[model samples]
Target: MKQLQAELHMAMLMITHDLGIVANMADEVVVMYHGRVMEAGSLDDIFRDPRHPYLRALMRAVPRFNMAPGERLTPIREARASTEHLISGAARPHVAHAHDGPLLTVRGLTKRFTTRRTSWFGAKPGGEVLAVDDVSLEVRRGECLGLVGESGCGKTTTAKMIMRAMRPDAGEIVFNEQGVPRDVLALEGDDLFAYRRKVQFVFQDPFSSLNPRMTAYDIISEPLVIHRIGDADERFARVKELMGLVGLDIRFLRRYPHSFSGGQRQRIGIARALALSPELLLCDEPVSALDVSVQAQVLNLLLDLQDALSLTYILISHNLAVVNYLADRIAVMCAGRIVEVASYDELFRNPVHPYTRALFAAVPDPDLDRKLDFAALMEGKASNPAAWPQPFCLDGSVKLPLLDVGDGHLVRASADADVSELRA
Candidate 1:
């Protein structure tokens, strides 16, 4: 779309949650919140020096690769209702990890799909698509593991397999409960129900994920009701407790999803996910549908919840900034395979994969001194395995493996490539 606009010399009005897209494609920016324009200026002015309180919070909420250690995200608190006491008391339930092992491990995961072509006459068989290909990773206890990629890169498919929403064609998914390893794919009947209770999902779209017919109270308490955990009174109390945790007002319990703002609706979703008291949370672009100011609030709330509940998260997103803000480690996926996996800091400091480098290069830096290099972008060609340099390129004949590049960082390169050559 960007290429088409550029080639046609067309002026496009783009609406997106991705600041990187703004930096790359937009000349002017208008930041909005609560149906009001918070700030408006040229791209440089908006990103480099935001003046509005909401705008500033939004800027801070976005994760930058060059950020220093111990930096914290500052979410907008002016619009939020007071619930400090509720938050403080909500930190009671803590799940202990066995030693320091990963809470979840996914190995050799693969999924395939066959597309059929439809014509005026009839439907014809089409080629097979590799949605996910032999992907493996681990989610450490109480830490966020971010899965990042461009669209159609299988990030969401991988998350679905982990949630067991869809069965994988091949692979093993293990959830380590304390010390015992449970095969997620092999479970059935009551065990699967129990697993669902231990792991919950937060969808990306707030409006569609929620049912407009259901009140906030019913929406949140539905999970509890399904599980048959508590009686009517007890479920109502739990719903109220959840509302407080997500910073929603108790009075809004009677209101429908349509009555609330996008951020509030997301909070309600989080509250619903928490109803089961899951140890692991799979957030599929939870904040992508929200406004900039609201995005900060939601991100901050997720952080707080993770800290308080000792929750482990598998956050799937295309936004590098969002993932960098929350993830302890990151995995870069391309062509339905993981090309790079590294610590949050390591990946940014030194990205080995060509695709990974292209992703970082595309991100618009807020600093005035550092501007995006349009020529360096290569018009998105870096994503193609065929376009990569010698050792990194993967053809059908050559076998490539994820090689350890020291300090626990790994990069997928040709097995024949020497460590020195791979480093280069």
Candidate 2:
């Protein structure tokens, strides 16, 4: 902050998991889970008047420092079937003012991969792994929608599909191009290539994303050369400008990726993402790979870039706190499906999804008096991941219904009434 104040400049992208930093620096926040936005709003609205179930659970999960010594704090709930109603809202026109029109839209999207196995004859695959199953979402211009979930929940795969790095099995990806709705999945040849220029990605691992053999200037300029957007002189000039835009020293342009720290490399990644002046940027765990302190800087950079360039973003990560700070809306995902979606404040105050609550509970809160032993909690429950047929429904017989209780809040139902309710 001191350096930025002294330079009178800021970053282009910032990704992180900390809330304190966000409270101090962020103008908006979007909470996500499993490649979906669950809640979103301005910073004050989210923290002070959270309206979503997932957001509420997350806030409760924040460890505090002033709890009476040994009193047991409330535990977060787990995802289940009975909470299905929580996923439904009162079906109103999507007239959210914070953001307008879908910048990126996914309808009836599904991605299934056939497993490759050895056979007597050169045989085709038998079964498939359904990574993403019938997911639909809309992100408007200049809006930040966060996707949050646990590990191995297909969050990264969803991002890849949006970036066209992975193909979807079935669905429509609609985006506005020159004032017309275009099917992103069908784009090819020059159209596809051009779309790539308009929609860019900031990878999770900044160090790996940046080429070791290339100088920072080369890295930033490479996009211009490939897109054939500007002449050599213009590209060089743009490269220096990008360096400055991302809060990096122009002198560092000649330096290699390995020459800089993790946070600096991420800045380079941001500069490269901006080379095309993209309308949308897909962030895949952008801050997970950086140090805690460094994460804040990168996150701030992203926010600054969004404001300066009018960039819309789809932020993917498993960190609820981070999502709460960056997203305008959030979607909670579990087992390849979105269990709930709501504005940031709504979701934080009253999350309906059991899975969402469990996720929040998993977060260690110092303020609360709670035990931290998962094995003990699951003594009667199955301990092995594979042993459990499903992450949400541990027992095969359990079925959940999505219900909208009120104010756009949805919850999954469980057989046991206790299961349907969040653990206190």
Candidate 3:
């Protein structure tokens, strides 16, 4: 971090599967799995007061601090009942916290794609796969809302909708500012262009997101040029300033994307996003592909930028620890739906969803004293959406009708069945 020569007192925004790193780095935490949030809290709260069933499983999965050499760590279990409509309630009292208000809301958003026919198969048509299904969510001003899920759970799809990179078939995207809600998806022409300026996207791959041919200066200044925000001199000045804001040296501006390292590339991507001075930033797995050290640097930069700019961000990722540290609130997403939503501290203390529990159980423990790997115990447990067993939830049993169990904690309605039943 010192070698990068970043700015002052950098605040971290970490994302990782490793819990030990989380314990050491995160000020707060959010636990998630299978696109659903299982828990979140301060590092101590998650370690000390794990009220959610899933959380307990995660704790046990951590190799025992004192155990026989050959003994295996126990994997977390799921409920026997179907997850179609189960609702798990909070075990602790609810507490309300301050939020900056909804800056963006996605309502009834849905998208689908039909696979193109193959010539060898006589142009056989492929069925439609629903990527996003009537999903609704809101990000408060100056707030980080974490969107979590397993791979292919539509986390990236949802982020793309926010970026207008992919159009939703059915939904209303409302951008609320100063108590006024404007339908973002319905706008066109200059209105749409203006809306694009208001919302910017930061992709997961820094290597591919940038134009290889363009220098960092051109890449960052492109948005300014397209939007006609500043003249040549001012745009150049802004580019240099943004590079510095993201902890990059001014000398980097003349270099192409390939000239930098993974971490440096991401910083340039961030600088471009800031060029438009967007109000809402849609971050799609921004740190997933980087090294542990690099991840920390990028995460820290994000936190510093948020504080400095008071920006609203919708952060999408599979890593729970990252969300736990940075997000004020969280929503766990499943196949095309938001299965649970809650404040960071409250949810971590008491997770209400079964999938959420399973996800938490999947996290690897680096500091565990035991030699057993809990992930192996969890194999054949995650749900497979296609060819699922009767009353199956792609992993195990889980009913629908995800219920809001009060205090803003939402979970699958079938929260009664215990671990034994979940495995049966």
- Ranked candidates, highest lDDT first: 1, 3, 2
Could you tell me the lDDT of residue 310 within candidate 3? Answer: 65
Q: Model 3, range 4-33, lDDT digits (tens) per residue? A: 324556766777765555654566888877
Which regions of candidate 3 deviate over 4 angstroms? 1-101, 119-121, 369-378, 385-399, 414-424
lDDT of each: 0.84, 0.68, 0.70
Q: How high is each candidate's TM-score?
A: 0.89, 0.68, 0.71
Q: Could you tally the backbone clashes for each prediction?
A: 0, 82, 35
Candidate 1 Cα outliers beyond 4 Å, as residue runs: 1-58, 77-94, 98-100, 420-424
Candidate 1, after superposition: displacement of residue 388 in Å? 1.3
Residue 246 lDDT in candidate 2: 78
Candidate 1: tens digits of C-alpha lDDT, residues 1-424:
7679879989889987656557667789998778998889998888778899876766676666666776766665633533455445533455665584888999999999999999997999989999999999998888899999998999889999999999999999999876889999999999999999989999999999999999999999999989998899888888888888888999999999999999999999999999988889999999888876578788878887887777889998888878998899999999899999999888988888889888877777654455677666667798888888878997764558899887778899977668665555
Best by TM-score: 1
What's model 2's overall lDDT?
A: 0.68
Q: Give the per-residue lDDT of model 2 (tens digit) for 1-424.
A: 5247449775523444545445545567887766798888887788788788866665553323232333222323311112122124211112234434577898867888788777878776778776786777778877888888887677888888888999888888988764578889989999999899889999999978888999988899998999897788888877777777777878887999898988889888988998887888999888889865466567766766676666788888888766766677888877666767777666776765556655655544322134233443243232222233232453443445444555545444443435324422
